[model samples]
Target chain A: MHISYNQKEVLKGINLSVEKGEVVSFIGPSGTGKTTLLKCINYLEKPQQGEIQIGDLHLNYQSLSKQDILKLRRKTAMVFQMFNIFKHKTVIQNVMDAQIAVQKKSKNEAYAMSLKQLENVGLKDKINEYPSRLSGGQLQRVGIARGLALEPELILFDEPTSALDPELVEEVLKVIEDVAKSGMTTLLVTHEMDFAKRISDKVVFMENGHIVEVGTPEQIFEKSVNVRTRQFLKKIYAEQDQQKLNIKGG
Target chain B: MTLETGMQELLMEFLKTLPINIIIIILSAALGLLFAVLLTFVRLKRIPVISQLADLYVSFARSVPGLILLFIAYFGIPKVLPLIGLGTYDISPMHAAIISMGFYHSGYISEVFRPAYLAVEKSQHEAADSLGYTPMQKFFRIILPQMVPVALPGYGNALVYLIHDTSLIFAIGIVDIMGTAELSIARSYGTNQILIYFIIALMFSAMCFTTDGLVRKLEKRVAIR
Candidate 1:
């Protein structure tokens, strides 16, 4: 779908669709509107110019009203670049707060759901611990578990691993990869190119607020039609590939 | 027998005025809480002129000392209220004292909250909004609960200030513990300086020690996440 912001088109008349159980990766340089695009899709920031339909929910700018957007958000979850776990609560409490408060799930039911999600993210042991007690990777997993607790239809990841330490990125990426394989419809904004190539069914290359290339993993990574896509990929992948070749040569 | 007579006089004098003294403390505390809440709300809303005025009130009250504030409110309000025909109202020293103590200390409580409100991660607000929490839910469920641990420390200090500052109410003719003690000692002992000091210190220490313990326990229990 097309998305625009402030009347100066960001997703200028773009078009795409995700089949159920497809994992899509949106890769681009910073400030190229990757995060804004995710916000628009989730109805956090209303898109002035296009339609956003998640599952059966139809949302235009009109549906961006407070109550309507909230209803829509219940169906869609977005994990932010920064882990937004409540600092005043334990990891489990953070997961249970919304469940018990808004969803009105009983404490017993909420605790059960919270435990299942935390277990899925491998943070079951840290349930009673506060966010400050966790490492960057651990916190991100808790954040992932928080979004998962809602059992959202579609999950949006906005640069989930970008904020992590280099060594910690793998753990977060592995969790995302597992979710992607679970056949949950996913849209991820990521700098981890190998991760995108490994798990994404479709990869959309965005540049200058528009999609320059959109295709399956094989089509986009191996065979490309656009010169800009080729150049961008070369610049992004050059260093890592060079180091790999040097190691092989030795 | 002479000492016993002094104790009887103290109790009688205190009981005679007890009704008004309690009223003054309660009503003034309610008023102080109201102003404190208003000042905090105004500061949160970023009302430039009002926040500045609040800051001025707090600084002046804390600087001059609680006793001085009591003196000014008691003597000065009578003069100023005349223009408002509040002049007809007899502003008692106790009334002035209660007003000064509650308001003067509220300023410090508001300052304690400022940093805490800022310390809340911006992302928590965003997540709550994304989850579709209404304005009220966003506040009571999310914001205010988080703010509790931060505000408790300040609230503890304010309570202690409220208790100690009650002594100033004696100056306004409220026959409280301090006032009754002073009266009984004046009549019975005539001029027993050492006994008076010991009695005053021992009585105040009990209250102080208890309040301090409560504050310490609350701080440990409410440790922030």
Candidate 2:
């Protein structure tokens, strides 16, 4: 598949697939089209040329009708970097909206399902509160709950922890780790190299709109053959070491 | 008549016309809000011809003076109706006032609403889409509620202006408060003109103040926090 914005290619001839129950993470530098690739999977940003197959649903961006696109989207849920809960809705309503609107569930059933999902994310006490009242960690947990409520075939996380404070990152990552352990198919675009190493079964390295390397986390982190992949990993590790040093010296 | 009786008679006349003024203000404001929503939707969707027409209507309504628009509605619409093969029809002054004020204020209301709708972050829409929400579902559930708090301040202002504009109905000879005041002044040979005008001013101010307080309370209730 290929994608472009304003005639500049953003994703070029990319071919990748995820097996059921596998956790895959894409890690790359900023402006490397990691988020764009995730968005294209659910047709949020239409690729100029691509065919996406998620389970039984197949969509060609060039020819798919509106209904087909909606069908494709139903198979996947996304957790945004900014934790974009509907501002006017309470936390439980955020989780319940899609179940009632898209899945056509009865209100009682949706309420029950949403409560369970919210409790799973450890937000049972915050159900009636609006997003503005929640902290960054709590908001992201609500976002995860909203994604999980649909019971989609795949869940996409787009840099979910990047917007959180350093102390709040662990709470969100722990929820994601639990989701990974549950054997759900997952695709993530993340900058948290250590978390990615721990949770992802497969890690993909992308640069300049191309997938530069794909392997097990150890293989990509410790034994990368490509010069660009090796350099990127080395730079990320050096920055982490510097931060640790600053903390120790302070 | 003596000064005391004259004052009493003027007060009675003002009270008689108050209900008509209130009715016109409420009806025009409701109609204006409906039209504003339609205009904002069209402009947001960027539907080619209809969007351009909405833009034209807003610009035309905003640029023309309110009294001129009232005259056009009262005198001009009857002439245009016949050309459309609908036979001549008399547009009552009350209907003319409502229609003209509704369309005129809708232009201002659309200006208020469009920006409020756009002010909602793009990520909200993307999240809704990724969740598989249909467009209608996204709008009502996600978009419209957020827009209300943002749009309320401007909507309140528009309502106040509508209240002031209702006095213009006297141009078409409707016996609203301003018209009734004019009639009372004429009957008194301009002896109580200053008092009548002063009372009308006070009534308008009171209505505006009441609207402002109500809107502020509503804003506090619906505030995002």
> Each model's TM-score?
0.80, 0.95
Which has the greatest DockQ? 2
Backbone clash pairs for candidate 1 read none
**Fnat scores for every prediction:** 0.49, 0.88
Judge candidate 2 at residue A117 and give its lDDT. 92
lDDT of 2 at A247: 100
| Model 2 ranges off by over 4 Å | A1-8
As a whole number from 0 to 100, the lDDT of residue A149 in candidate 2 is 92
Give the Cα error of residue A162 in candidate 1, in Å.
2.3
Q: Give me the displacement of residue A219 in model 2, in angstroms.
A: 1.8
| Model 1 per-residue lDDT tens digits across residues B102-182 | 777667666666666766767888878766566678777778777777777777777666666776777767677677668
